[model samples]
Target: MTVIKGCRLICPNNTHDPILIPDREPVYVGRSEATRCIDPRCSRKQLEVIADWESGEVTVRQLGLNSSAIDGIELEKDRKCKLPKGGTIYLLVGMYPQRVEFTYKESPKSPSSPKTENSEKKNKEKKEALKRPASDHTSSNPKVKKPRISSVQGSKSHEIENGSADKAVEEDEEDIKQLEEKLKILKKNAAEKKFAFSSDSEGLLADNEQKKMTSSGKGKRGGGETSGSSLSKTLSDGSSLKKTSAGSCKSPATKSSSAGSDSLNRSAKESEGPPATETKWQPFEKLYVCTRKGVRARDKIAGFDIDGTIITTQSGKTFPTHSGDWRILYPEIPGRLKKLHADGYKIVFFTNQLGVSKGKTTIEDLKTKFGSVLDKLGVPAQILISTGGGMYRKPAQGMWDFLCQKANDGIKVNIDDSLYVGDAAGRPEKWATKKKKDFSCSDRLFAMNIGVKFYTPEEFFMFQKTAPFSLPEFDPRATVSARIVDPPSASLTSKSQEVVVLVGFPACGKSFFSKTHMIPKGYVHVNRDTLGSWKKCVDVCAKALREGQSVVIDNTNPDKESRQRYTNCAKTAKVPCRCFFFTATITQARHNERYREMIDKSHQPINDMIMNTFKSKLKVPELSEGFTEILRINFVPKFKDSKNERLYKQYLLEK
Candidate 1:
């Protein structure tokens, strides 16, 4: 028998030809046509396999975003493991399994250790036993028990005594089919190699040479039967085979074959597919919440984001191609979640799915997708999904608040022990190898708003050191006050009638400042929102000034042209025009707007379009824009109640 040198990688489902592992060199395996791996989640260079013939081992390194496994042990990205002669390697969470097989030449036996008469006689008897029919051998063996299918209640009693015979039979048949497929493959390769020789005489000469070497070498190692014949006999007696505790099917003569490799063990169940989950998710206010069976609300909470954190698109896409297009982000996720559950921490997944509100995906589909993920994790958990923007969306503590206040069954959460893990931590591009910049900082901000510790997915799952990240410039937690006006002696009102135009972005405290400070001083308030248009506001301002009263224009007079309108009005009315330029940034205004939405539901939500439009048109109110005086008005937030003040201090922008 000829022994092939080095290791061979055989992906039974993906390719018929085995890939030869080059000695001391890395061979890349992935979705590339060369590797013949069609799994979409497999990257072009998903795995790096380095074979060492001298050591009889292979070094495998994970290089892709998804995870691979070696003999059931997880091999994560940038991590490597040494695999022995016959070990199975799984790509993308136990899919596309390829077994590495190391081949070696059998040492020849010495003629001085010739077989004795007794050993020769035993060998002849073993050959005769192999030629006997399997049925006759089974009937002759006293230890083998025949299945009893009786009439009346005897059949039911027999089933209760020995378990389901039909299931056992089905498993045996399946195992036999797999074994036959391997045998056929081996035969096909052997026949191809046999014909490749120059001539029949050369092939015959090689066979005679092998026989002489075997006769002159070490004694027969096993039952002296070829693997092909041994496998055929095993399949013929498949009905008598029993599953061992290790989940392998074996017969008494199974040890005769030297071909007991990892490929046979590949039939071990890797995944049973996603478990069927019931739709138990219920709507709580604006959040879609689901508590898996056996989950309990605990003091310590382990919160995670659904997308990019727990699971990712199996298609290697940013967005999923379908509802079922997803896989566990890392192989360690399930084990870690289980550990957290054992530590009395309630597992929770917080996700913002604005597309649900926009009709991109249905709520039922999201529920199914989430259910599949939870099922794969095999742990009891709770999921909170925010379908639309508002309090429930991340960067707002609405979901956290609801979990503590409404859900949790009245149990108080210990913020000190609770921490959130997500991918969107405001990390810049190249924060890690091949890591892209996060789309938003909502996860980090959500943890900040809930006053709990936060961690990115890499830090939590991979146990990596904290990476550098930036937060939004506007810190709502800061309570120290700054100067209300740029000039220390700037007065709120003048003794003579004057036109005061508030120049700032919307929600920058322009309306509040005019109503609180100017309106009570006999100055007529003018607003575009109230009067409908800028023309109407101008008319109202001119009318108030014509009556010898001071007018306060509370509108976002952003550009020089808009501020010129009010300044021209003051000039025509023979009064001084002053610009109260509000020095508030766009981020601060956005934070204030969201705070208002939370406190007052009637306050219309200001979208990014409105804020961006104001920013684009802004030219910075200047003394050159025909103003008698230009005073900078700083935004100083005030709260009526202590609860409102607490809420105001929480982060509101996603950034």
Candidate 2:
């Protein structure tokens, strides 16, 4: 045998580089002789191998190139020939003469095996058996014979005696028919049971049909009868049933059809029972108002005054007073009263009417007129009238006490929270002044003295409608206390660092005071005129306060009601508040010479009449009632002297 080593071959078509195998096992086989052969038809390059008997040598037959254009080549060296390209290379191992001869032999054919032949025969037999007809159970016989038990019960025996075959066939057929009938009955019973259990009969029917198709032969007639009886019992016990004559009509279609009829009859028998009842409300039930203190107050009592308060008389004929007449509810008044009601404040018109005793108006007529006025005003509550009596009249507190006793049934008022609003004294012209008539009546004064918080119509209206006062909650006691503690002064800087509100007639030194005093003293000046230019000035002021800045409002805050807004704002910001009234006398105001200049320079025309009206209506800041501080500004000589710095310093220091 010859072996080849260290031989290489390369093919042009092979894209991947070949792996070089060194020290690989060589293979040898017997051959007749060693021959030199070339296959030109082969696409692979030809390589040659030569054998040497002496020294066990193998040589390359032709090309000795290290690399070749050939696709693959075989080589052998020493013991056996090696073709690295071939998966397994062959070598001739038998001994041969120096001149060896080669010969080729043909391969022999293989004989058939018995197992294969037997399997083929078995398959042919199976095909023939499948092509044959099925066996028949019936035979031609007049007599009805009994069925062979083995044949009917699926036995392995295939044949029966001719005498008994006919009987066996007949018996088998009868058994099949019975089984089918039982299956149908079982199916019907299952359907009825399913329908009884389901809320929807239509769905139950569909499910039953599907079940029957899937479980055709498994159902039994006896099982169906038992299931049907159970279903009937369920339906008869007040369970829902199809109520119709159709339900009661049993068809031979199913055994449960008759049971359904019996259930329907039972349901009809139970339908004769009595029905259920309903409820109603009791008489003498009433709605009452109760305080957080557990005090129950009167529901509808309202008191009215007779004099200039409720009735205004032109000459002799009596008519409703502007302040007294409920007919002409001020635009801002209704909304305010509604808000008070929403906050649980009972709205009762408390007034002292003495005209009945004076014989100016009869009690009956007055009541009728008052009732008409209240109706016109849409006052839905009841009215309590106290007339003629001296004790129950103005400045006496008798009338309020009487009404309270009657309405409250002796329940004392939490006086601190109650409010009294009226126009004038019990006698209107009694307190009239030379320059102006006193709108505050004696009754009003009495109410005020008795500690009832009094507010004029204008004051109440303004406070109710505007910001700050429009806040959802307020405590008058705290407000009055704060006002009494820190009275207003001309000096901007107070120990409390309170917010000062400048209020008076338009252009009546409000803005001037704010800019001249408040701003210079590190007080924040919040002018409504400036704020009015922007939509959300109050919000801006609130923000500044949140950041710890005190604010002063510059506005025509003529009424106590208007001033209340600023006071309330101060309260909300947890800051003290004061009111500064620019109380310049008419003489000084007209002669100052600056007034005309201001009027001329003003963008809005200042009507003198309107200005005077506003000034006259300006309510003095009620420091004892609802304000932290109140200051009166008077015009003194040298009020504007540029060199009187000492006097200015003195005023500032004293304030």
Candidate 3:
């Protein structure tokens, strides 16, 4: 197949900039001048469909768009070499922002789905098996019990148990038909009852009106002067018996009021009927999606992570070396992707571009690079750019959910058939070889979060099968299930007010975990970052200690020198000081630092220099640091909002 892409503007609104058109067939481009503005002299039928796909003869076709005529014209009809004049022929595709180009590139045709073919072969095998005698496959053991059912029912049961294709469909159809019948009966009964109730309500309303009129008429009226005088005398004598009894015995008015309320409620329920069963989702456009074309519903979905999984910097830099510095990791990548496309899978590329969100990289650069790569691969694809760390980022379900709901053309994705490819497999470092592992396991967790199959690029594309990789100390799901080992003096620490110091490098999840656990548990937190100095932290700790409050000093106390200040203050206050050592690796800490720097701007930023300085000075906190107790504080990541989860992990195609 050959694809033709447009590079120039063909519409007044400049909607069409770069458009892809496969070179296999002639493409129709038309316009509607009625709804949109078009130059009066411009032709309504702007473009004629004509293409040459290396065939001896070229074909041409004209299609109408909302009454506009497209002329049919074919060039180089005979096999002769007619080098026609070629430049930019700007054409439009109706009122849409799609431009047509004559330039074409060769591409591969889409192949049939592998799943469909496999199912057909399986069906043939099943038919052959059914033809054979059951005794042939039956166990020789006499104790083996056979199912107790008639031949017809037994065969159906066997089909259901084995999950055969046709029998399952038949059973499902029968079940649906029965449900429809039941629904129809229910609707009929509801309609009849509503109609009867309406008739009864009309009579009740008239009766209520009559009762109101009769009750109003029977009310005793004070008769002229003599009755007024007598009433005054009776009131003076405190004989208000008649008026009290009459007020209490107004049963007709009360009954009418009650009946009216019941009728209104019944009418409201009848009109509203049962609530809608569907839970409507927000439109796909409402989501945070930077999208590319070539997306639609498919049985099999091909999901891939962008940056590391698809393209890597040729310069071997941590970030992008330059705009065009990226090169495909493996030559096999394109072939693997092309196969997925041919096999009826909608290819989608998902990337968390934090730099774009942080104003370091523009979305246009990402689009251009992605377009170039996809063009090189010669495949139509879908690209989802998660422009920020929140909600739509990896390890979150927003992107996956939107695709399954809206982008897939309302087709429900079969999770078993779909798989995600990414590079962040959380492999631990082999220090002896000086090899570093991945930043985090966000990709694997993203797959886990969505409940789909996951494979690293090496395993899937290069067939590098090996042992499973390691996971980080942090588990997003198990954040709440932290195993809190008691301090040596557990009774004193829990019940008595004492000073606690957190020791770790920057972005090691010290402050986050403390906020969630410590502050809520009546532990006052003292942070040097917020207080502006270690002296202020000490002051705050001393004041809290004086106030009989247990304080937690939340800071990256890198070494014994930094930790001694807090321990000394606790000792001066006659309080036991305990150290909570954060147990995340340097790689994890660096990953978190990068995530904070690029994605979340709200938190204080940690530069590479600071991270390096901390690493150089990092010392494990021992009991000799003058702490009464040393507790291990493992990293635990928790997200308050499901849509926005931790996203510091990088997806790399190569280790």
Candidate 3: misplaced stretches above 4 Å? 1-294, 305-339, 352-361, 372-376, 387-398, 422-449, 455-482, 487-489, 492-498, 505-525, 542-552, 573-576, 580-602, 605-625, 631-655
Would you list the clashing residue pairs of candidate 1?
108-217, 108-218, 109-216, 109-217, 109-218
Count clashing pairs, candidate 1: 5
lDDT (Cα, tens digit) per residue for candidate 3, span 1-655: 5654432224435644443344555444444443243544334554444545444232333232221211101111121222122312323212233223355466776676999887777777545543444343233312223334446764877656545544454554455456667878887555433221113412222344324324443211111111222222222332222112111111133343544333333332311112223322121211324333444446467899976788788899868866788889888899989898777677877777656534466555766787788777777666676655444667665578767765555555657678998977676775225546767677887787677789888778888774357665544343342554344334324668888888887888888878877888899989987899988888898899889999989998888998998888888889888888877766567656655554453355566688789889988888887888888776655544543353423321111
Question: In model 2, which regions exceed 4 Å deviation?
Answer: 1-326, 382-384, 409-411, 425-436, 464-655
lDDT of 2 at 83: 21
Our tally of clashes for model 2 stands at 28
Tell me how far candidate 1 lies from the true structure as C-alpha RMSD in angstroms: 28.4
Model 1 / residue 86 / CA error / Å: 60
Better of 1 and 3 by lDDT: 1
| lDDT score for candidate 3 against the true structure | 0.57
TM-score of each: 0.57, 0.23, 0.44
**Ten contiguous residues with the weakest lDDT in model 2:** 279-288
lDDT against the true structure, each candidate: 0.75, 0.42, 0.57
Instruction: Indicate which candidate wins on TM-score.
Output: 1
Which candidate ranks first by lDDT, i.e. highest? 1
Give the count of colliding residue pairs in each prediction: 5, 28, 5
